[model samples]
Target: MTRRVEFQLIEKEITRIDSLVSRGETELSWKSDGVLEYMVELGELVEGLWRRIKSAQMNVGKIKAALDAWTRTPLIARKDRRKDALLSFDERPEKVSRRYGEVERAAEQIHSLLEENKLLFQVGDGMEEPWQRYVAYVDGIVMESLRRAVGCSLGEWMLDVFCYDYC
Candidate 1:
């Protein structure tokens, strides 16, 4: 279905942007001006894609309804319409089912990547510091905002405080 094609296009664009971000990370210093600009540009692109995905999800829902209607309708229509309905019945179901999952995975990946970018700003926590593997910077404005919002300093929150095995 057309929604599947559109979804694939969005997926490709997200992947492209991610690749660019990854390349920049490898090629440029994290504290360099170029890296900051790249991070902002990447953030903007991800936000735009997020908005598009929200709207696209609605469009996909509409297309799914059309597919449902075609499948449920009587087969007494004109030849072309009947042919289309039949073709859609065969192809649309799988695309309709898979597109949602694909979009959801994309959204989750984007969120994770964005969180990683944000995490780069946090430092001196000393708790394994997985974020260290990504980038380095001292001015954690984003982390400060989060700290203000949460009313606590995450850097001081020792990993041992959490009982989860993953932590």
Candidate 2:
């Protein structure tokens, strides 16, 4: 889950930073280059995150698929939100939470990583993380994509890795 979230952010950041770079014409200033260099670093991380997410996703999918062959997808006993149900019934919410946490941790890491490179920007060096402002935007896109892509749906595939003991 965390891997998925990080993967999504990494992709979006690469696109966003690249676009900013393309539109930028700042006279080789340190912040500009810091942005550029960090963007490059971000791109590398994003690609790495994507590969890992895809692998984890497929692995989870495979695990689910295998379980699906015999395991019945559990349905909610009463009408309730999926997340609520998943938290209450899904035995492996830890996996999702752990996955989600990984992305969160990465954002923290990248924030500092981006700043260290931002020294190249040669401006606003001390207290604030210069790159902090961009984190929310990129993180939002990542979460939104995953929510849009995989969440808000009911399907047989959902039941494999996450078995509903309550249902």
Candidate 3:
């Protein structure tokens, strides 16, 4: 999928996971058979979102590498001129620089999301019970992921919450 489409899918899944967590928080019965099934579905959704996050990270890495390679390569080689001569011959350096900037921005966003939620992703890894694990995972990860997916920085999110409560 295109990068835009992949990002859209990730955002959609984040919303869906958030909705599930909201329902699970207030409505789900911990001891009901239906709750077990709900937890199972949530687990599947989280796993899928994790996979997509990894894939997007990898793609960003690849694009950055390609941009790096392009920047290093000389469009023309002239032995008669100084080393700086090759810099002048570089093709559309501005375009490459803009593309590189875009890639770097994307990489930074993805990196920040992963870094912020690193522990949350592993919340229930060692748990022995599926329902308990899923509950923990949803409570720990979904809200944070939703915040990031919605393009809110931590400070911004906190401000919004503060405003909602006190303003």
Candidate 4:
């Protein structure tokens, strides 16, 4: 559903933010001491959150696909491309139930993070719903990170140009 899609999009945004942060840190590390140091802890936290969101996305995707497959072929054999295994009619419920448990746990982890960090995330108009707010907040974060990265790159290029002209 929408929650699963939001989770996947948020996961992708998290990955993008991490990449931007890593690049920024690497660039600053060569000529800095404390600037990048502070990011280390923040980066770890983001990584931890990303891992949870990723786990949730994977589990949800798997469960959704399995359920859809079962719905389509309620009493027939089907080739489960995700697991690369043949699933008989009798095996659908058991597998779906098992995956549903995993999905619940992962989803709870994500929801917990959202609840704890509600202030850090933006909740604007049309984002009255939890999932909508989450998607908007993560997308906003991704955009902000990209803007910062671009600004940093520009500053670095200007510095190089000035050094070349003077020296």
Highest lDDT against the true fold, candidate: 3
Can you write out model 1's per-residue Cα lDDT over 79-165, one digit (the tens) per residue?
Answer: 355322222235446655564554455446444543543333222345234333322221232344334423322211322234233
RMSD score of candidate 3 (Å): 19.1
Which ranges of candidate 4 are over 4 A from the true structure? Answer: 1-27, 72-127, 130-167
Models sorted by TM-score, best on top: 3, 1, 4, 2
**Model 1 misplaced regions, further than 4 Å:** 1-4, 63-167
Residue-wise C-alpha lDDT for candidate 4, range 1-167, written one tens digit per residue: 23544544345456766776786767666467666665776677677665655655564444344334323322323345322233344676876576567446644654555554443333344445755655565445445544554565455445545655674
Q: Each candidate's TM vs. the true structure?
A: 0.33, 0.27, 0.41, 0.32
lDDT for model 3, please.
0.51
Against the unseen true structure, what C-alpha lDDT does each candidate score?
Answer: 0.45, 0.45, 0.51, 0.51
The segments of candidate 2 whose C-alpha lies over 4 angstroms from its true place after superposition are 1-90, 125-167
Q: What is candidate 2's local distance difference test score?
A: 0.45
Count of clashing residue pairs in every prediction = 0, 6, 0, 0
Q: Encode model 2's per-residue lDDT on 38-137: one tens digit a residue.
A: 5676578557645655654454344333323222322322235354444334434754565456546644654554443334222243424433543454
Pull out the clashing pairs in model 1: none
